[model samples]
Target: MSTCGGEGPEEREREWEDAAEAVAYDSSTWPPPVVAVCGPGNSGKSAFSRLLLNTLLGRYKKVAYLDTDVGQPEFTPPGFVSLHVLEEQTKDLTMLYLRPPKRCFFFGDVGAHKNPKLLLSYIFGLYDYFLQELYCFNETDDPKKSAIPLVINTSGWVKGIGLHVLSEILRYVSPSIVIRLRTTSEGKNLPDGAFWLDVREGDSRVNIIEIRASQNSPRHLLVKKEARMIRDLRLVAYFRQCLPRDFSVFSYDDLVQGFAAIEPFQLPLSKIQVIDLHCQISDDAQHDFLAGTIVGLGSSKCVSLSTECPFPWCIGLGFIKAVNIPGNFILLITPASRRLLANVDIIFRSCIVAPTCLLQLQVSDEVDDITDRLRDL
Candidate 1:
């Protein structure tokens, strides 16, 4: 695990290394360790989680990651709580490279403050999915065989409702180990020792390890401007997949131009249902509101207009390039495979808006040619 910039790399290494060793090699523990990393904003929680994940990869063939930080998720884009099974070590943890998760739910907002309960429900659902499908019991006596360990990376918002949400998560998950990163500013740090546990609980058994947050890396301590830029870059990177694998983009402008010219999928309005998670839109306004916005592409056996409908299994994201009311179809740009798109019957609109640059691009006249060549499904 490399440090961005920090005074005590050796001490940080020792702290996480010891935790990793316990999780990977400790046979006394029956089930594998469920480690939850929590802290306030810019407290190196993500970095530590990545380091711990890489360390565990040395011992286990696969490690499960429950990413609850929708604002800046580890494996998926913003506004998603996902569960990912990582089989190989991440070469560069610093890079925000998007990877498909085994299971995920789109919360439709960057922050959990909008709908904390909904967010937690999604997190719990993903965790349950992991426990049922990916978590190994390790009944075999062979030393080589072991249960897959889980690393939970929590959101940076650790105050007020965020704190309550964290406590609820701790209560539900009851992880074997809780690693709390200590920020330099006392005001920003989480409560000391088992903070999530109530004082009335009488000495919680959950092991708590506290380490100083890395100070050297400016990126780790993201300001509002940098954070916004990173999110935008991530969105652009995700949409860039729509281009040909052999296509060469010389710069961001070139990439924007590529997206502007690319042919978008045309889906009949009757074939898909739209649900806005944040606000209500009138039937007449649905098409206009969805145009030029990022939407969660999902598939469900049954669809409901109610916001409380059982969360749909989101396949991926799509950008609504246009709303062809005359044609009774929508022009969408997404990188999801054709097979996955075939089953998409629900479109979830959240606050996850497309980057202004991509949305502002004027569709080239070539788009009509491309659209004409590609048949509407």
Candidate 2:
């Protein structure tokens, strides 16, 4: 084994451009090119995927993105595996803006180490949906003109069970191209060649592109504190939808205050069922446990709550401000419109939680005055 000198940012950028161009121009893949970007944590998988997406958009009218990184998803919030059809190019690669996915499934947790099977099921479902709805059945002499190419942005978990999950995804999707970003830290990089395939598989046709990961990348080191802050910021941004477009929130503290003052929607408890995906809660303790927690608002055909119930279609997420057991109603805050809310028949609670700052209220005098006025009303 030999080691080489580190490459500069320019060289890395060039390599990324070359890889993206290759995927965009590759004519061999029949059902439009399906590209998968995979690597260990903080290895620039998301950055490369975005570049590939932008590059592909230059040639194809529309490209489908399958985001499997529930911890830090590209389009939707954490705890979801989603597919988005992007017709327009991403204006700024640095901006972390949220977009509604064409289809999504909330897995209720950030990492798949606990429930890899469930995560894989959701991912497979999304890929199948993309094939059926977007890619397959669109026949034309010029495949590029009709068929939408898919770019799969995978999770950073590359060792142990994470690796197993990645292998399953590769086997199932069998993408035309697999780009693995390599880091100088050999321990942090995935195994060479088709790491997902077993020795018996023998000479897979998947075009493998290996590029040295950029050291200049800000996320090169997976710092827990930084990662947690980023997740919290993303959550804040998501919930900020509850505010009016003209409303200004200049800082995190301001956002917290805004959330504290925002009026929440009240829903009759009888109309909706609640299920805890992570664990079971006693009937008496359900309300207390749910208060101030973030939950998935889903539409389900089943009226009763049961572990056996099939996963529902997640309409959006809501923050359970209060669970008024006495009133037989719940106060929730969400960005989902009333039209979408009307179909929400179930609430799924997962490991995802509202940041502590958002929950702790330092009531301002204005808020107190408003409360008194409301009470008088």
Pairs of residues clashing in candidate 2 = none
Candidate 2 lDDT, 1-377, residue by residue in tens: 11223378776788888888888986765667898998887788998899999999998889999999999898777888888989999999988979998877778888997778778877887777676567755466655436788999999889988889999999989987899888867888888888778799998988888876755344545666776777887888888888888889777787777887778777777887777766657766666787778888887742212232247557788888766555566778899999888788788887886787668744344335444555677
Candidate 1: list runs displaced more than 4 Å.
Answer: 1-7, 136-146, 216-222, 280-284, 302-309, 364-377
The parts of candidate 2 lying over 4 Å away from their true place are 1-6, 138-146, 216-222, 280-284, 301-309, 361-377
**In model 2, what is the error at residue 58, expressed in angstroms?**
0.5
lDDT of 2: 0.79
Index of the highest-lDDT prediction: 2
> For candidate 1, lDDT tens digit of each residue in 1-377?
22223357787667666766766676765567789999888877888899889988987788899999988887777988888888899898787768888878888888988788888888877777766566646546653334688999999899998898998898888898888777667887788777667689987767776777765344545477777777888888888899988889997688878898777787777888888776667766877788888999998853322343267768899998777665567778999998888888899988876798678766545346445655564
Q: Lowest summed lDDT over 10 consecutive residues: which window, candidate 2?
A: 301-310
Instruction: Please report the TM-score between candidate 1 and the true structure.
Output: 0.87
Worst 10 residues of 1 by lDDT: 301-310
